[model samples]
Target: MTRRNRRMARLALPRLAFLVVPAFLAGCASPPVRFYTLGAPAIATGAVPTGIVTPATPVVEVARVTLPDYLDGQDIVVRAGNQIERSATGRWASRLSLGATDLITAQLARGRTDLFVTDQPQSLPATWRLAVNISRLDVTRDGTASLEADWSIIPHDANLPILHSRAAFTQAGAAATDGDTARLTQAVLEQLAERIVAGWPR
Candidate 1:
């Protein structure tokens, strides 16, 4: 309408545009989150056995699974020269401890349907219980996922009196992409499962 009013309107337009443009750009620039599981596709196909057995195997309970302080967070963590960085867009579908427990249960039950494996507290009498503590689990810049853990199994009761064994191990993951770190992590867990089964009383 007036000359002064027109000048004020022009000045306001640039300020409004400056504020709005950045907000719009930030929204567009922000990355979308990509969630991943600990295992499945990355592990070798048919590596897990199939088919149910005639006699059901003993009930096994996953008592507890723990992770290192650095890896206890929700984000996908990578280690570089003793510095750990969390991925802004890459993340785990669930907690690493829970994922590890689930992966361990699946790997053990893959071939042996007879064995009833569970993560919850045993309602019925549990013949065996497993506890695992992971010290270091992270994907590095070198394209390798590594896992270090200690685990043990305890039998409720046995005529043969199975001895409790405590073992610690370090396993390397094989994966082509950084995004496939979960797969490599799963492979490491499979190796841990095999070790536990090997020590089970026959």
Candidate 2:
């Protein structure tokens, strides 16, 4: 109420306001929430043809194939070299390592003859080894999907390869979405499996 008291109150008000304003501003500011997409659905194929004779006595154990450094994760880089933003459903982000491994496993399983295939690494008493290499896997903006795979089967002792093959397959879908991509990939793998199985030695 007094003049001096009023002057002191006026000076203190600004300091209090400064502190309160910062606290309010800090509360208002928050880190943005990051979003990711759910992976696409897996494609299915018909049962593998009968009489393939996939190692009746387990003569060879198929080893897990090594994937290239690129295409190792769901961190996808678009055609323009920019990372694609993941959708709310978690599609179109990228393929996981396990996904690639599974794809190869399934392909081999369908084509396997006189060989046992597995994803786990193990030292097995087997007569042969199978190796796989994935060269390119991509889904273009135009909805065309492409896949290239190289594979070989060799005797455990000899360096010479018993069976060597390379396959490239493509499928065009209505869209470049994850669902379409998975479908196309599955189709290509199925075809490749058939080819490999047809050529496999009995």
Q: Which digits, one per residue and each the tens of the lDDT, describe model 2 over residues 87-193?
A: 33323233544555555555655556335555555566556565667677665666666778888867766754588899888877744554555566556655655
Residue lDDT tens for model 1, 44-119: 3213244443334577787657998767756787777789877777888888787777777766656444566667
Reference-based TM-score of each model: 0.75, 0.58
Worst 10 residues of 1 by lDDT: 40-49
Whose TM-score is greatest here? 1
Q: What is the lDDT of residue 97 in candidate 2?
A: 46
Candidate 2 minimal-lDDT segment of 10 residues: 38-47
**Whole-model lDDT, model 2:** 0.56
Model 2 ranges off by over 4 Å = 1-56, 76-97, 111-114, 157-161
